[model samples]
Target: MATTLFFLLFFTPFLYSAAAPNHNAPQDLVRSSCINASYPSLCLRTLSSYSGPTGTPRDLAQAAVKVGLARARKASTYLKTSVTGKSERERAALSDCVEQMAESVDELSKTLSELKHLRGETFEFQMSNARTWVSAALTYEDTCVDGFEGVDRKVKGDVKKKITNVAMVTSNALYMIRRLDESGGLNR
Candidate 1:
């Protein structure tokens, strides 16, 4: 009984350690998947936050879009609050950025919806739409930054920094969507 207890205590940790990497296999997949993203580190950071299934390209694509949507929403709230205590021009720019972020959120929502319902018969068509919407979301993010031009330097810098972060995440989402498309649209 003493020998069995010693074996159980000594070997249990080794058994758990051996299985630990398999538990982290999903995170490793996320890391490798992010390697090709425009913002690889951000992609890894954002998608790694998802505790859902990440065993397939579709799963990763959905996670990316969801992360982008959440960021866009948060940015919109920040922009709205930032409109106060700004010059008139800065206020205008912030207002435009708010609208652009709203559009971005809408596009990302549509992309997420499409990703969730990707059927084999219409797989190509759905993927094309998803890519188009994600690309449009990225464009809207870029336009938000463009609106900040000619505003106060500090305001422009602050707004640009926030918008750029959102844009990078959205761009990463687009990359994931394209990767999903190239992965044969859910067949893998």
Candidate 2:
């Protein structure tokens, strides 16, 4: 009986350790982190595909950055190829707006690279760089919308909607990155 007890005590921990980490942990982390975002629903939607039950926060944050980068790029491409406005003045504004969106894509790409390069020793610095890039990307998205200020309502509305989607995702990525930074989840 004593031998059996010893074996139980010694092997129990090893058995437990061999099991997988809780699958729900990552989903909970995602929900808790997104609670503090400017647009919680948008954050959740943007990350829903990546924030799985077995997800790691660092992975989640990185995925958000990558997805946001792709979205920014797509929006920029659409703007560049689409014809806008009925007049020369409107066309000029639309062209400038496309350039802004292109810059926004660049910023998002930088944010993704910053997130991917995160190191425990340089976590703060990396996060700061990501935050700055995301902020600038959001600003560029906003500026694109603003460029349509004097255009016709239909044109402005259509352009604003498209740019706003990218901006919201960028904002969500920033919030997720902030969670990774402040929560010290990068090293996990």
Candidate 3:
């Protein structure tokens, strides 16, 4: 009985370890990390699709900014190519929205760059900059949608839908950055 007990004790750990989920797996790390995001499911979707490291808050924040940047770029391209306003006002709004999307892309790129090099004594300052840039990116996205307010219903709907998706993603990125700041992950 003692031998059997010892064998169980020794093997049990191995069995459990083998069966347990890998917390360090990139997807799992992103999933847990995105739980506090404003749009958790969207955060999961965007960050999971990114083929990058996500082992730390900084890594996750960087990945998120990358995703947001890509989405903003796509939206900007789509606005430039696919959208056309039937009326002059609609055209103006579309123009303004396209510009805002471009600005969002630029801000997200800056945020990703900042997040990538966060270290040393400037870790907190770098994180703050990243958060601010991401926040600006989200703001640009929101402004893009706001420009569509007086547009034709169909145009407004279509533009709002597209910009709103980008905004949500950017907002999630901002949330991730904020969570990183609050986590004090930079200190470690």
Q: Pick the candidate with the highest TM-score.
A: 1
- Candidate 1: 10-residue stretch with minimal lDDT: 18-27
lDDT of 1 by residue, 50-165 (tens): 87787678888898888889889998999999988888988999999999999999999999999998899999999999989988998999999998778888888988888888
Number of clashing pairs, model 1?
Answer: 0
Candidate 2 per-residue C-alpha lDDT over 103-188 given as tens digits, one digit per residue, 9 for 90 to 100: 88888888877776778898888888988988998988888888887787987787788888888878888887887887787665
Lowest lDDT 10-mer window, candidate 2?
45-54
Best-fitting candidate, measured by lDDT?
Answer: 1
Using lDDT as the measure, what is the rank order of every candidate, best first? 1, 3, 2
Alpha-carbon error at 66 in model 1, in Å?
Answer: 0.7
Model 3 lowest lDDT segment of ten: 78-87
Question: Which candidate do you rate higher for TM-score, 1 or 3?
Answer: 1
TM-score of each: 0.86, 0.81, 0.84
Query: Candidates' lDDT values, in order?
Result: 0.89, 0.78, 0.82
lDDT of 3 by residue, 1-115 (tens): 9999999999999999999988768777788888878899999887887787777777787777777888889888878875553688888888888899888888898888877
Q: What is the lDDT of residue 46 in candidate 1?
A: 84
